[model samples]
Target: MRHDDDGLIAADALDRVTWAMRRAEWAAQAWKDQRLRPLGLAAAQYTLLINVHSDPGLTGAELARRLNVTPQAVASQVTRLEERGHLERRPHPRHRHVQELHLTDAGREILRDADAVIVEIERQIAEKLGPEKTSQLRALLDEVADAVRAP
Candidate 1:
């Protein structure tokens, strides 16, 4: 007797909420890909840059945990960013084996530009969703994420 918003009968696993979440993720990734193409950055790279900008001195292993990626993956991205002069790995203050990440001046400049692009994209999304609904949606998503992370 249950029907989705489209009037189609929904499967138990692929309900309206799940479908919406999946489509939203796909669309957002596609949009980010298009926007970042000219900047020569992928969504993952941009995410890494943003994370490092926000939390300076994070190690590759820490970034891996925060980004939900493998340490090897983080290392690879770190190498790429370092090669581009976007970031550098400095000696950790306490740990001899761990290297802390630091964004370069070039990285900061590029990150500022990337932030503008993301802000514009977010502005468009907010315009469509309206401020109230957009806030509600963000709060709901954060709550869901927190709940999932709860022990």
Candidate 2:
């Protein structure tokens, strides 16, 4: 495919929109990786940690559902975090088969530092997009996601 003026591969309008969304996701992940690497986390791992920290007692299955990932994938990340002593799986109070996730002290500390990185990234993006445009972009993106999820 030939590239358009913006250097994105040329396609029909809808395809170009999808391509732009994909590129934006990729670029965001790359930027997150650059910031997270020095903090001893990958972007995916950081996301997992943050989710567990935010939702304190979610099981792997629950997290997978929330993240739109497979349970197996969430389980693997949980295993890695457990091995690193960043998180722990405790017996669920209500169910025999379910285990509740909790962040250890290290996990909390790392997440606190990661939040600073996330804030700085948001600031940079807002500066690049301009405050008004950034807010508009966020609303438009949320609308896009909501539209895709609509039946």
Candidate 3:
């Protein structure tokens, strides 16, 4: 092993890490492009819709918290979906000014389509990685997330 004159070893480690991150991002975008693009939904919008549909009757603030986005961002997405007739906003039971979101019939139908796309994506990933390795990868990624968030 040769070291640079600056006494820095593992110079390539940084490059490798950068490459890995970019590769993972590219793979994710590719999957989203194939799965969500034809449905007229961006990946972020699809995720928001799915999350809201799964946790119905949640306020925009609550949804923003769960989605780790600003309330305004959630509101913007919700507004678009509402205009498209996929979702609706109603008065919250407890909050006076806050509105709770619900998926309309069309929203549910779109969600089903999105779910099918997601299922196909998962199946393709599983076929490529195999079940055990896929699980292992998930565990390892979770560990990384935990470590990153640790105090």
Candidate 4:
């Protein structure tokens, strides 16, 4: 990589797009972690909570697929959250050996607080990008996501 006028990495066309995406992901994760740290949550943990919050009854296998982690990893984390009273596992309806994750009352409250923190960060992003660019950015990112997900 070469340095541009501001001593930033000067990437070629393709690398520029990929590098920008990766850098944005890393920066967002770090910022989110910092913001969520005071709530005693890591980015990954918050991700788990938010996903379950979005979908009330997701199994660990489903979560592993969504989070792209191994089953054992999710199981351990889910156990910790259950112990913390932030999450609970309920028997899946009509399933002999399956359980679904759901947020506890405590977990819902935590998600509310965390959403305030996250919303601030998002608003900061929108304010910087402005309405038009932010809208365009969302469309572009979605297009890229669709492309990558397509088989």
Candidate 5:
């Protein structure tokens, strides 16, 4: 049995899947190092902040679900953010045992700074891949995400 030199069978769907996974990992690390670390935020923390900003009253469990993480993990990150003065926990309107998450004024300001870093990273990627190709790549990735998330 001869192995393909490219380590992929011709026209194999798994080839694209494997490539996409590796590319995503590499891109995430690069973005984190080049864009997020300088902002004094880890990628997870940044993601949490963005989620809370977008959904200001989400509970810890809701955030975990949205982020595909465990509630404990979300709670830990939330605790850190609250300690940093970037987030606040308020009594849930209807749930006596749960609290809703909100971004503090500092959180909003930090998010704006993070957005600038993200925009700059996107701009750099666009320059490397060109606008048309970058847009196409994003659309293709979105399709992949939708397909993977379909139940």
Candidate 6:
């Protein structure tokens, strides 16, 4: 007789690769959040800041697409970050209905600090996994992500 995970899918149905990835994600997020807490940044907010910093002119809709989130979600976060003086939106040069995103000086400073923290986190992971394994892990994770994103 085949048994499931007690009202859930069968035990064998929980593929190890997926579970391991999920576990790592949860752990990494918790670790990043804990470290970023002193800097007043959540994982998602830090990600948003990084995106704006990297491109410096993405509209909320564009950001939503990049972040794989809804425009409404991006809007509220943008509003909140703006209120905190972390970022600002200026009217788009060509599009009246769209606003371009930019990080403020404060945003730049905080992002710099947060980046240092994140670098340390990455260094630790690399140290734990060693260089070769770390590279392999990154490639494997990217492949998994690509597979999931592929229609």
lDDT tens digits, residues 18-129, model 2?
7799999999999999998999888888899989988899999999999899999999988988998889999999899899999999899888898899899989999999
Poorest 10 consecutive residues by lDDT, candidate 1: 2-11
- Per-residue alpha-carbon lDDT of candidate 3 for residues 1-151, written as tens digits (9 for 90 to 100): 6454564556576578547867986888678767788887777778888887788888888888988999999989998899988889999888788888899999998888988888888888889999999999889888877887899
Best candidate according to lDDT: 6
Considering only N, C-alpha and C atoms within 3 Å, which residue pairs clash in candidate 4?
none
Local distance difference test, per candidate?
Answer: 0.90, 0.90, 0.84, 0.91, 0.87, 0.93
- Pairs that collide in candidate 3 are none
Clashing pairs in 2: none
TM-score of every prediction relative to native: 0.87, 0.88, 0.80, 0.86, 0.84, 0.88
Q: Mind giving the per-residue lDDT tens digits that candidate 4 earns over 1-151?
A: 7545563534465467877999999999999999999998778888899999999999999999999999999998898888989999999998969999999999999888988999999999999999999999999999999999999
Q: After superposition, how far is residue 90 of candidate 1 from its true place, in Å?
A: 0.2
State each model's C-alpha RMSD to the native: 5.1, 4.5, 4.6, 5.0, 4.0, 3.0
Better candidate number, 2 or 3, judged by lDDT: 2
Off by over 4 Å in 3: 1-23
Candidate 5 per-residue C-alpha lDDT over 1-151 given as tens digits, one digit per residue, 9 for 90 to 100: 8666674647676568768788877886677666777777877888899999988999999999999999999999999899989999999989899999999999998888987887787788789999899999899889988998899
Clashing pairs in 5: none
The full ranking of all candidates by lDDT, starting with the best, is 6, 4, 2, 1, 5, 3
Question: Lowest summed lDDT over 10 consecutive residues: which window, candidate 3?
Answer: 2-11
Which is better, 5 or 6, measured by lDDT? 6
lDDT of 1 by residue, 42-70 (tens): 77888999999999999999999999999
Q: Which ranges in model 1 have alpha carbons more than 4 Å from their true place?
A: 1-10
